[model samples]
Target: MQTTFENPRYPFKHHSDLNQGTAVHHPVVIVGAGPTGLAMGLDLAMQGIPSVILDDNNTVSVGSRAICFAKRTLEILNRYRCVSPMLEKGVTWKKGKVFFQQDLVYEFDLLPEKKHKLPAFINLQQYYLEQYLVEFIDTQQQVDLRWLNRVTEVTPGVKGNRLKVETPEGSYVLTCDYMLVADGANSPIRKQLGLESRGQVFKDRFLIADVLMQAEFPTERWFWFDPPFHPNQSALLHRQADDVWRIDLQLGWDADPQREVLEANIRPRLEAMLGEDVDFQLEWASVYTFQCRKLDSFIHDRVIFLGDAAHQVSPFGARGANGAIQSVDNLGWKLASVLKQQGPTTLLKTYDIERQMAADENILNSTRATDFITPKNKISRVFRDATLQLAKDYEFARTLVNSGRLSTPARYLDSPLNTLDDEEAFDGGVAPGSAALDAPIIIGDKTSWLIDILGTRFTLLIAIDKTDISRVGESLPELLQSVGVDLVPIFLFSESTDLEVPKGAMCICDPWGYVAQRYQLEPGTCYLFRPDQVVAGRWREFTSDSLISAVNRALGFDMEVMP
Candidate 1:
């Protein structure tokens, strides 16, 4: 299996528990071996939580499925040092162009900011993503990945969830304190539990054709609506790793999905898009209809659902896998803290609450984007065409244009975990309950990104000036501990030169004032960041008592409404 980014088959190995009559117990067991499940295991491994990942197949996904991974997803994966292989193999890009009737109407840069380590998005085949996750998980002894281990039945329980896994040898009983259901859209686990994902399935089909070709096209996303190449349909062109181009052609509900994927039928379409003289090989093709749906609750006792198993969305925004990864990022720490008794079990409820909100937001956006892409009636199509036409000229109309509202991390603005800003007037910064933004920073002499410094811990980011840093950096940690709160103090300085860490505290040098500019910070500004890199609270004036209350509220310890 020592090859490039291709479909790699894994050898199934027999485990000693196969013949054991009694159920082998584990603290955590993930139901699917897809990208999110593997990542969940890796995240738990980073938290010193061992997990088992069971997959029905022994190979990376057959076709190129989620080809786009957003910056947020990359940052999460980079936490465990597994994103290097993906960044190296994936096609990195930021700009994307939207076309209407063969003319470019608008273009966008997903990440227009500088100083961030990761790109806006990378186009790597889904199989390669899974392969990279599995490869990384192989190195970690905490993750026990069993290929060809299919869960035949799931029995949810109060203490543990019982799963009957059928492997190559025989069936075995397995029990886990927590069961993460990451199985895909058609999740059998979700079905076995008599739960269903509720939402709208658009009445349209899309053909995914991964073609091997040598083309002069730049590495930008090209999406067209009613282009001359396909007459009345939408089409998309993207570059993946290894010269494999991902082409998505929209087919109305009446088209025969089975027949449209044939090489004979797809060749003419490609020739029309690319010139008739274009030489290409069809690597893979599949027809799919997207839906925006999710369960009523992600948490069902000891069994929790993650990714597609809990919710599903149209792939238009690349939110399917990206959202799943973000959920894992949110859950890994909360679950670990609960299992380790660092936080109350009620903290797990926040993951259910927060991720459901994200699922709803993604569904709402995806539903709207789908409606814009495929207008059901002629009147709707007229409005769509008019908007597209106007977008070519007017800036205001460009705002109305909805090709797809590209994926970004969900802002949990109203989350219960947030500590609302009190009477202190604040300008702009990472809002409480929203994910933290990255900026340029330096440590000692070597320059580093802000995200790399915000490790998976409760961070107390103190925006300190040169005058107060020496005193604050040395005393802040002990002061917080005396207040019965533990926080990893990261001092942000506005000076370019390296500062002496006499107390061996974490220091960030914001030479160019990027941190202050990005966070809208003053000398005394302080921000509390959760282990998931989410801002739980921030204050204009720092205080140990206030921070302790905020920390308790963030951990679901204090239910009182206090800012």
Candidate 2:
């Protein structure tokens, strides 16, 4: 059966010149309506900040690009209430397999822990994710999404940024207090500002093809090194939604990129892998080279670069889109707070520091994966083959196999925002500046995930016995509020207790002790979380003055308080 292709409608109705003769000023202007731009706009809107998103194109992504969505990215999407559609439409998988010449070498499970709400990864076409985000943006009154609007020029001024945007009808001038340049790797804005991303570009080329076929293959990542069909090359196969299978074939530097993408050349390769009798239709194909590069700093005065505009990584680990969404998650709350005057602009500086650290980590991992996959010389090839052969027998050798390291959230251990644990000595607990892990909790006959309750603002989480709730609830809120910090206190109690909760704070039962095990809970332990759901500080026992000092430090006010 042949697969049918239905292109999404791209309406070019929102022309900026339509509102001519009026000088328009926006608080925040986001260039490009890709995942990063759309996510940032929606997150800012959720925080009561208005933004205008401009995109030269009027449609979602063209191909099934960036199909792997990590768990952290899903959590960020859940915060916008747009994850349901993705979960419904996406194919969830946690297991992956590796093969050496048609022989199964080893397999791995990404998230062995069943306690979390979301799986380790989901395979959804990028177009579907972008479509869902655009729909969510439509419901948000604070977001003004204008398609077919291209940014031609950007000038940073003392007051704000002066922008020249071109639409199909005409061009118009606009101003914004802050600008987000998410225009992608070949960012015109980055070039306009004379900025360059410094890093290495690998020589190997890869052919990515999306094939629509009905196959009995399980929904797991299948990777083959030196397969019988494609000799001395690596091939990856992954299942996506709507019977679409993403296949990536490694074509060395000498392979003609143009000839490799042709249907005549690609069909034989598909026939050799999946039998010649199997009926399939070509959905999309692209030939590209891998590069690992990133800007020295994501922030440029009033202009902030995000997503592909700041960082670029090889597609092996599925880090590009996942990392970009994380960048949006980190910047959204801080930018909103700074714009609202609730926090100093220095808070935005932390975004550059944190994300640059994340970018560097990604580049390092990607570079390692590239080197292992495509060995430059004979010695490297021998080592790679030896590791693969040994991985089939020894468990320790499996660790050395680098199909891809996979994307994990970057823990900001050295961030300035973290209030270090000076007095406490707990192992494997939720530390300051780390992303908070979720556990299952019970709330009034409803089973809920911990992350559903603790997002969007600064929160004080107290893990205490049911008997101590009233005592802590009586004074903590008032004490924290007096220091200009309005905190929402969440009380977590053990499952055995059935006690009346205090009036000021919300209560939940940690049913399976997952919270206790994960958070390293102790009596009188409390945690302070930032708006982006990263831990700001924690204390085994804290006085009012100590808590106030920690709060000030978390908001970058300690520098201001210094003599």
Residue pairs of candidate 1 with colliding backbone atoms: none
**Superposed model 1: Cα runs more than 4 Å off:** 1-6, 470-486, 496-504, 560-563
lDDT string for model 1 (1-563, tens) is 11235567899898878868799999999989999899999999988899999999888888889999999999899888889999999999999999999799998888888888899999999998998888888899999999999999988998889999998788999999999999888999998999988989899999999988899999999999999998789999999998999999998998899899898998898899998898888889989997999999999999999999999999888999999999999999889888888788878888888998899999988999999999999999999999999998889998877777888998988788888896346767778988889887888888888888674778888887777766665666577566443467777778754566535357777888888888889888999998788999999867777778778888877644322
How many pairs in model 2 have backbone atoms within 3 A of each other, for residues 3 or more apart or on separate chains, i.e. clashes? 0
- Tell me the lDDT of model 2 at 156: 86
True lDDT of residue 357, candidate 2: 86
Instruction: Tell me how far the alpha carbon of residue 476 in candidate 1 is from the true structure, in angstroms, after superposition.
Output: 3.7
Residue lDDT tens for model 2, 1-563: 23334547768775554687765788999999989999999889888899999999988878888999999999888889999999999999999999998799998999998789888999999999999999988899999899898999889875689899888888888889999999998999999999999999999899999999999999999999999989999999999999999999999998899999899999999998899999999888989899999998888888999999999999999999999999998998888878878778888888898898899999989999999999999999999999999999999999989988899988888888788886446676988878889899998788999888776777878888756766766776578557675467787888746676555667888879998889888877888888778888888874676677777777777664322
Please provide TM-scores, in order, for all candidate models, with all chains considered together.
0.96, 0.96
lDDT of 1: 0.87
